[model samples]
Target: MSTTPTPTPIPTPTPTPSLTLTRPAPTDNPTKPLIILCDGTWCGRETNTRSNIYKLAELFGVRIGARIQSPDGVLYLEGVGLGSSFLDYIFNGITGQDIAQQCITIYEYLVHNYTYPTHEIWLFGLSRGAYLARAVAGMINNCGIVHPLRIAGTNEIDAPQTRLLCETVYNLYRSPYATNAPHAPQSLRFRQTKSWPLIGDEDPADRTAPRFHPPIRFMGLLDTVGSLGMPEYTGGVGLDWPVFYDQHVSTVVANVHHAVSLHDRLFVFQPCLVSRDHARHCRRDWERFGVTRQEWLPGCHYDLGRQRFRFLREFGGGWLESLLASRWFGFASKVIEPNHVLADLALRWMLLAIRAQSTTVNYEVVANIERVIEDVTESIRGRAREPGRTGDGDVYGHVLSYAPFGSLLLDVVRTLRGTRGKVSALYQLFFDLRDRLIPDDNAVVYDFYGFDEDIPGCVGDLARVSERRYPSKSYVKWRLRQ
Candidate 1:
């Protein structure tokens, strides 16, 4: 019997978001594919949280302290980052600074840490992470990724040669402004970080000039909310937040997969909204490659995203929440509010509630949540149809996931309208009622994700988002660009 070839060793790490070097998967094939997954804001790489990115990583058998049996030749590595914590997410989550950092960090980690002469590269992400993945693809397609060893004059920091070279690299990958944006189509920033006359986008096969550009096989994203310079969930805009997410798409990537959420409506959450205009631009970019698939799924932001933290994982799904998921509005409307005492009370109360529940999830309770949904959906629609309502084109259809509970909860505080407490009550009551609901077998399961195969929290392929949902009459918010 022939012996197995030795796995390739990774180079020294200079600065990476997070690098994982492991033995090749248990397979005889020669080509080992590297799959890098990025998590969204507040998506912890640690074991405590339930990030879909991690779930995908686990599927690839790329873990911190475990060996996995993967299909064929596969070596998994993930580049994770968004902000420091769930708090930084409140402000810096989608800033250009953060996106740029993630893009560069991931690129450096991959290009420097590993050399995949014969392996495939796949980029996967959700929410802001998706934006970064697409941005990375754009950079590679335009301003190719360079190896760390290729960064010249590292020994002499003050040298002009070193300064210019470092600035070029930094501006290309991490700068908020790209003065050469006109030449670079992937990123549309007009000041800096833009492409400067085929500087990095040289021929791929060429061995000279610190170059190694791997063709990304696929880009899979879930509800890519490239909010561009939207204000923070808590308050204020990022100093480095790019004014525009821009009209750039990587021309090199082979295929694109985007899972769109039809029902995500929370004001602060709305800024990250991926518009139909952006979708059209993406399609145009991927047109030559002929690999663009976009789908619309039901549920609120959490239903679409499935970002479960410690509190949700232990408690599981509720009438309003699947895996205790809530959008930025949940905290932005509460804990981050200017009120000092109330925020503390809310935090303590939430901790108490989470502590009260056992880690064991109750499926029966989740199954019965449909009753609550039906009640709330019908109730909200009835109120909206009262007078001068767009019966056929109500916003509810677009935000089916969150509108019901959000509307009903709003009714509870209609008496005390405009106060922070009123808004808090709306959000608070929704979660409270969700956790308390019991099962109702009489309720037929509603198909939120239009697929026959049930991938809970939707940790699956974007192509699986379904073809039937494409021509939906409900009018998902993706308007074609003029």
Candidate 2:
């Protein structure tokens, strides 16, 4: 053995396994961002109606390159506004039972998927859906996000228990005097508690300490109609209910963007306007950064939200419909056609706002959005041209520029006969009276082309009559016939 001293055949020092301490790629991080899109009453993907909310969902999908509800990527949730069915519309929609349920649905989603302070929440909505969005935000403001309950010895979320927790939290949020009174002690306790069993835990020594989960990143609203019932009827039965009225901008919401319809004057469709005082106080941090915006864009609610074209395409029919549908083929020849261009413009403005305010930067989303803006800008420019002016000019000639005047009249009649008949006619009458009585205040009116420095692209020379022209001081003058 001393011979060739196989010298303890020095075991080849097993190369210490080199460990490359590498960080996860940005996409691989456990952080899960959430987006909740709540569509207007009777609107949702199931209905195949492409409202702004629907389009937004599509844009988000494109941006993430994943289907909604994908486990590996962003979690997207949609709350079909109150009326998905006639019965549902009558019972739940009218009474706001649907709104409560929708809030619970969203809250449960948060419980299941929301990661503590790391997750970002973005909400978007139209009409009643906007109310739903605000309500959910308020719930989160009052009752912190509920932690998901997991099954014993497993990673799976306990769905029933999580739902029960969400319901309990919501009840506390909507409790009597919730808005006026100090935060409910139960809700505060919930926020301070660490786990899902939610049994008695040592309360924080400082009871008055503000308790809440991470603030909502952004809330984008289009024509937020807070009324609970049918617009045709008196502004819903529960107009004065605290639940409906309390859906204000909470301090926990970081940024707010509201695009209002300047031309809408329906008494029943009263806007739940963002509280300017509250916005000023809550968004102090973002206001200097110019992140919060509330613009009164040109058009009716349908126009601002871009819901009519798709809706009409789906449900438009009758003698009037046949005629309008016929003329749609010759849309290029008609001047003063439906305010579809205005709708497109409104959509573009919202997209720009989202791009500006979103915390995450997705180059593909930005590029796609830019392309959409360019295309929309070009279409608007082409549409704004006078008849018989250029190759893209109205082929029907200048005299025929007013030819669509009859079509416009027919459209009005058609609208009067449709589901929106009573409401649309009433608003039209009010607006007509308003225009006649109130002197046009150019100073107060917004120029369609008066592009916000933040929002790029020119919208041509269209003038958006200020919503103020209808009600505000002008209304008193009109009432007095001064």
Candidate 3:
């Protein structure tokens, strides 16, 4: 002992193991992910009282499995004034103001009072809220440091980390600038930047970047009364986002008719300014990729949020779904694997939660979308019966023959499920979309009992009229039409 002379006691630092917890499975008593709602233009802690905000929360609460369906521990933040440091600097030109930090503070508050069996957090925002969500997400992921915001001189607190299922209203008024105005370069500056929180630069190996960007995706409605494509707004210019993100992300542009049309709207005409291409561009891109534009009808930005469509709100929004679902389950299958069953279920729950939460819906959008689906279905059915068809017997089969068309049709159906309303011009718009999708005259092969005749005169006429605007490109368009 004396020889050993107690070598100056070496203090062995105990390493902290990564934190993990067990909760009831979703089926038995699903743990709800924490729900945080960021405020819109002028929001505050009480935003949950607002119709839109409340609805989003309710829907999210209903979405978590069973245990958390009530969302008692859910925390709501206005995400207004000054919070996210980056946004505070960007919006208020003030440095070190972190709204995201405030978010973390609120989150920590819940942890103290609640069990926090699940780390998955569900974040909802509209317009300005979207920007706040983005900033908060970045801060949480980039810097483990969370800066909680003081609410109306409230006590200091810890913010919670959440999986965001945020939706931005791309309507004229909600955008950075009014839809009818001139395209501003500053509006899209952020989109052009390569760095963003969570979503990183495009991987050269992946080609979807130029279109989908990162976590942010564009969901537009169609209506001559509304703006088309991307509007040049002072803020929320997704075009400023990375061309692609290593984080697997995708975009869905449901073509709801007339309520929020993009057709000849100024934004639609100036695709270059907003980094957006016209329907022709989407069509052309899809054609090149052997896919087609998936056009749905009757729903606008708001309408899509109301209805419980798994594809638009969740399945397609895998970014949000995987984040929330895995938060509690700790299941890598849903987060990492493409087409994982749990992931799909998570998507369904998201849609259900959103639908359950949102009460506001454009009735007109619902009717219009339903009508469009009917029209397309009838249109395809009629085409299938032509005297000189030469392909598959079933209507779906013929549509699937053209992979692009099939994909487009599938998306259209998906949108219809989430939309409402019936604009008079939507049927015409469908024909227009169909025409843009199928440009070749001889390529319209309707194979009914090997007759191999031309497309029906009605479809053919629509195609011809719609073709010149969208000239035939040499791209090898896929023949699938879902």
Off by over 4 Å in 1: 1-32, 45-47, 64-90, 93-97, 113-119, 150-170, 173-179, 182-214, 226-248, 271-288, 310-482
Global lDDT of model 3: 0.28
Error of 3 at 158 (Å): 9.7
lDDT of the structure predicted as candidate 1: 0.40
Displacement of residue 300 (Cα, Å) in model 2 is: 0.7
Model 3 RMSD vs true structure? 23.8
The count of residue-pair clashes in candidate 3 stands at 77
TM-score of 2: 0.62
lDDT of candidate 2 over 29-91, digit per residue (tens): 224457787777545433234567767776676332222343332334443433244345334
lDDT of 2: 0.53
Tens digits of lDDT, candidate 3, 257-304: 111111111211111111123222333332232111212111122221
**lDDT digits (tens) for residues 1-482 of candidate 1:** 99999999986444321111111111222144556676665465331344445555654555544333434333332223332343343346434336655665666545543343444456777667777777666555545444333235554223444334433554664445554442455443322232222222443354343322335655667656654443332333212233434334444454565655444444333323222223324333234333455454433344344553222211122333322334533531211111111111112222222222212222111123344334323432233223421111112222322332445544655545456643554433222211111122222222434432322222112222222322232222222211
Q: Which lDDT values do the candidates have, in the order given?
A: 0.40, 0.53, 0.28
Q: Which pairs of residues have clashing backbones in candidate 2?
A: none
Give Cα distance to truth, residue 335, candidate 1, Å: 14
The prediction achieving the highest lDDT against the true structure is: 2
